[model samples]
Target: MGEKFPEIQGGGSLILAWQVRNKKVLVIGGGEVAAGRILNLLNADAKVVLISPRDGLNSEVAHRIERKQVEYYDRKFEPSDLDDPAITMVLTAIDEPDASTQIWKLCKEKRIAANIADVPPECDFYFGSVHRDGPLQIMVSTNGNGPKMANIVRRRIAANLPPNIGDAIAKVGALRRKLRVVAPGTEEGPKRMQWMSKVCLKWSLEDLCEMEEQDMDELLQSYAPDQIPSLSQVRLGEEPGTWQFDGSFGWACVV
Candidate 1:
């Protein structure tokens, strides 16, 4: 038998309490490894800049840089590379460990957070495989030690996601204002969350609309600030349907 695989590793317990949209992220690499990290940053809408001298790299990467999808510098990184005011984080996968270490040191001295692909001790952060649905982003990590495993888990989880998830999120977001209007008190927060979760689990537009109307009716009896809403103890009801989605994400139910 082999070593039992860990359920998590490296930076698994980490959670992003803040959003990273439109932030600047720098990468110093030009190979397939760098491509994976770069693609994730792009998906997160970060302003990504890649520094590498390699020409005729992956065709799509070359095309994207040329099209200004990302900025590319056909040169090696320098000590002064940490100059971008907008750059809050950096990731490096350069072949030279010493060079990566030095770059990480420079980033730290300049107060920019950095992560090195294979140097976990030097990394202030770790990369993870991510799947997103509208405003919901799921990131899987085995720290930096097992990105492949993380990716495998990510794909499994993604396969279970219904195609309508994004649309369902959009519909739910549209209903929030109506929810707030009906449940006009701090006491309704938990009940409202429960209701939203119910609507999301069903993933039905008609059911969500009906839930919205029901919420409106429930809130018709406006309560004062100290008044306890009837739904204060309300629990999300039973799921209405069995999803046709894959079962690999069974673990996510507990999550």
Candidate 2:
């Protein structure tokens, strides 16, 4: 019914490179492409270092670096450009294979992660165009094969998410905490999630402002699991029908 995509790599690749909340990330080369990557890293709260050989740097980027929000180096690439011991990763967009190769070798010797633009084989990681929200980020990547397609997919997904999604998520968080308190011992996690799903489904169909308290209470109460008769007890006096248990971590069902 829907198109399937390849499994994503680096899902939990310890995205935090050092103390990323306030740490250093060095971006070599300057252009619109480098600007985009640096922006995303900055959003993750990484302190950025951008070095450009010439004057092609974006004005906004230069301004931020000048203001000390980011650091900029206006010089040609040198062997020492890769000598930032504090740098966690180096993203090179110099548009040259020999330079990228040399840089990769240097990074390897230094034990630093490096990404070469448009060169997956030489890159330790590939940059993905991403859109982020609080505690949630959507990354679209084509594994270094057509970032244009990735951008298209990202925009398509972005369109489906509206501005109110954040507020709705906050509301859900509040409801989840309330549920944990209200239904502590009576429900399992899966069942609780299902109950929340049903509530959201119903809420989607009605005007929340007009929702009645009695109706909401009735819906919540209905989510409580009804006690079922124990199978072992049912055949106590009979042949004691073969009670086979499918162990489910304290949730066994006798069949």
Candidate 3:
């Protein structure tokens, strides 16, 4: 008998954050799809150029055009638009299939990444569900297969996260900055990072959010005395064997 192998699933796309701030982005439609893409680009601080026939624009898109938030070209897309050296990416949501195909081909020839709405095979990327909390942003994708499912998953994950998670992250960042100054050495970065990871693992999100600088300094003294000069001889008044760490059972302390 011949050997058999398990079937593999569809190829997954790599998720990344594109640095598009202040870069030129081209959108080739002015309907709801184009409006949504424009808003997302604007949120990222990208300079957008929207091109579509004047009669084809939706009311919302027209309103933005009237306000001059975006550079609106009241005409159909032309190949010359792709020739702009400043254009970093292109997005097409035109109803005409031929126009969409032409835009995709032109983008490929120009080595510019592009997304064609409702056409996964023609797109270089897919629009995914995004959830943002301060500096923390989460993106969920279904490989251009199921957008509704991706949105549902994104909402569920967002709902389960603690409201103070962003605050906790900010506190940790401040602690890291302080540690860098107080503990200047070659291995300071990795050592402090490891200590911080351990602290995060052991402490609840609420505790992290509420912890003060003095409390963090004490924690550094207890867990990483060698890293900081001021914490070398500082002790938490606990015996050597009072606290124990078990690989399988986690951390425990004697009462």
Best-performing candidate as measured by TM-score:
3
What C-alpha lDDT do the candidate models reach, one value each? 0.67, 0.64, 0.78
Model 2 has a clash total of 0
Residue 93 Cα positional deviation in candidate 2, in Å, after optimal superposition: 1.6
Would you estimate the TM-scores of all the predictions? 0.67, 0.61, 0.74
Candidate 1 runs further than 4 Å off:
1-12, 54-56, 177-255
Identify the runs in model 2 with alpha carbons over 4 angstroms from their true place. 1-19, 170-255
lDDT of 3 by residue, 106-161 (tens): 99999999999999999888889998876567899998899999999999999997
RMSD of 2: 11.8
Candidate that would win on lDDT: 3
lDDT of 2 by residue, 42-134 (tens): 787998888886587777667667677778778856778767688888888777789889988998999988888888888877777676766
Give the per-residue lDDT digits (tens) of candidate 1, residues 120-223: 89988777788887766788878677878999999999998866556545555666666678676998897776655543443344443333445434432322
Poorest 10 consecutive residues of model 1 by lDDT? Answer: 246-255
- Please list all clashing residue pairs in model 2, or write none if there are none: none
Ranking by lDDT: 3, 1, 2
